[model samples]
Target: MSAPALERAQVQHRTVRVLALGQVLGGVAFGATVSLGALLAADISGEESLSGFATASVTLGAALCAIPLARLAAARGRRVALTLGNLFALVGIAIVITAAAMRVFPLLLVGVVLIGAGNAGNLQSRFAATDLAESAHRGRDLGVVVWATTVGGVLGPLLLTPGEALGRVVGMPPLTGAYLFSIVAQTAALALYLIALRPDPLLLAQRLARDDARVALPGADVDRPVAARYAMLAVAASHVVMASVMAMTPVHLQHLAHAGHAGHGGATEAVTLLVGITIALHVLGMYGLSPVFGWLADRWGRVRVVLLGQAVLATSLLIASTWPGERMAVVAALFLLGLGWSASTVSGAALLTESTPLAPRPRRQGMSDTLMTASAAVGAVLAGLVLGQWGYGVLALTGLALVALTTLLSPLGRR
Candidate 1:
């Protein structure tokens, strides 16, 4: 390798490692909030219906903040943009804790939204991983950073028990104990991004571009808007399908668990256990083997992997539709749904990054992430309506149709 190539390679390695650590921290914050936000809302408001808003607030926050953060990266750099995001999350954590203590439901919503803003930044970390990446190994590099999230994601929910115990000892508000850990995690991530993340990958790439004709730019056909448009569609569609299915899995599990039971209230614990286990497994499927799919994306080609992901999504929906009442089968289907989501999302992200040039990439990525989170938010709402009216069978079938449309559109992205 030439001297400059070796230096770039070394920086890429350092960047990925640093970004991975940051992701783990962000994962901890996200996992805790997602797992407990609804429960906290219900406890605060004394209205079960209001509980759903806790989650919606977070999603809304993420979507709302995506564009501004992208613009920040475009103006300042990834370092500043990401640090501000983590800071937003940290401040939000403090507010959540205060709101819990004050018994203010509206305040809690406000805090969670900021927390979601932090998550938006975390999601952008994947793109940062690719800023200095070699085209041949782009997917693999992105996957490793994504996979690092598994540690925080899996461990965060599991810490609820310990968090509760600690909260009691510390005389903290009921479920707000988890947010304490989030505070620490977000703070650490903020520090990491500020102190490290040197030369700012986005800025460095810009310099490299100015120094030489966009040397860091990924694929040859990337300059075309149509190609980038297709890549963005892939990212958006994958999220919509994943979020639509994932958002309703808990409800489906509850229905399945209580279908013919004599007393619905009596089996609450049993149902909770079943739902938690299945959801945990689903999380594993989403993140555990991401590196494998990332490798596939690199070797097999990005378009093919995305198409394969759509196929997997179709099969999962079929299984879910065919055997909605069979508990284990549904569990298996949900797991597959996560796997397919992981494949499509990771590959689609890599594709999107490569398809856009360095100068406009930051804003474009932000637009894509905004579309992703916003569409997922909409899909989750629609899925709830479908599940409530038509049932799980119809919801799964509905998702299957959406996946088919994505598959048909996949050809447009192929080079």
Candidate 2:
């Protein structure tokens, strides 16, 4: 490699490391609060219906914050935006603790919303990974950062019990114990972003791109508007499919197990364990092979990988819908569901990076994320109604239509 190329590669490497660490830390807090939000809401509101809103608030907050955060990253640089995200999370979690102590449900919801702002930061960090990356390695760089989340996401919920234990010792309210860990994890993430993400990858990349533009470097202005449109659609559709199916899996699992047990959960504990394991494996699928998919994206091309994601997601939905009563089928389907999401997301992000102008890239990226989150939220709401009114199989079938639509829109399939 040429000296400049080698240096750029090294800088990209360091940037990815810092981003990965921040992702892990942020994921820890996000995972912890998400795991506990529903339960806390149910306890505080005394209404099961209101419980969903707790989690919904976080999604809404993320959607609400995505554009602003992106704009900030555009104007002020990533370091400022990311650190601000963490600060929002820190303050929000603190408010959650106070709300719990005061027994105020509305206050808790508000706090969780702010926590979601932090999640927007976490999500954007993945794109930041690609800022300094060479086109050939962009997918890999984004993938590594995303893969890092697996560590903290897996560990976050596990900390719940320990957090509760600590809460007891510290005289914290029982329902809000998880927020304590969230505060610490978010703080660490904030500090890491502020301290280690030096010189700002986005800013550096923008300058480089501008210099290249000025010189009229070959392929510098290669535009792929069609591919970018397809990418956005694929990303949004894939997320909808994944979110809708995943939101109802636990409920479906319990119902199926009960039916098998003669309408009585004689193996309730066993069934619960099975559900937990299945979900964990699903999460693994979501993040574990991201590097491999990243490699595929760079090697094969973005649209092809997105097409593969749609195919996998369709198969998963089919299996889930066809054999709703089989636990193993459900597990396999959910795992594929996550894998498909990972493939589509990683590839779609890389495609987005390549398609847009560097100057407006962050803003557009944030806009896409806002749309993705909104689509997922809609899917989640629809999944509940579909599952409740028809059945889990029907819910999966509902998502299958979307999968097919995405397949048709795959850039490889187009002119």
Best candidate per lDDT, number? 1
Candidate 1 residue 46 Cα shift, in angstroms, is: 5.4
**Candidate 2: global Cα-lDDT?**
0.78
Estimate, for each residue in 1-415, the C-alpha lDDT of model 1 and write its tens digit.
6555566778889999999999888877777786677667767988644555666677778899999999998889899989989988988888888999999999999998898898888888999888888888999999999998888877776666567668888998987676678888888888999998997887777776666653544562367666677778877887777777666666566566777565656454454456556766667777888889899999998888888888888888899889988988888997888888889888988888888877788888999888888877777667766776777888888877667777888877775
Residue 70 CA error for candidate 1 (Å)?
A: 1.1
Write model 2 residue lDDT over 183-289, tens digit each, in one string: 88888888898899887887776666665443221233556677667777888889888877776676566566666777555555444445556666777777888
**Pairs of residues clashing in candidate 1:** none
TM-score of 2: 0.87
What lDDT is reached at residue 135 by model 2? 79
Q: TM-score, each model?
A: 0.89, 0.87
Residue 242, candidate 1: Cα error in Å is 1.7
For model 1, the stretches where C-alpha displacement exceeds 4 angstroms are 41-52, 98-104, 214-221, 251-276, 322-327
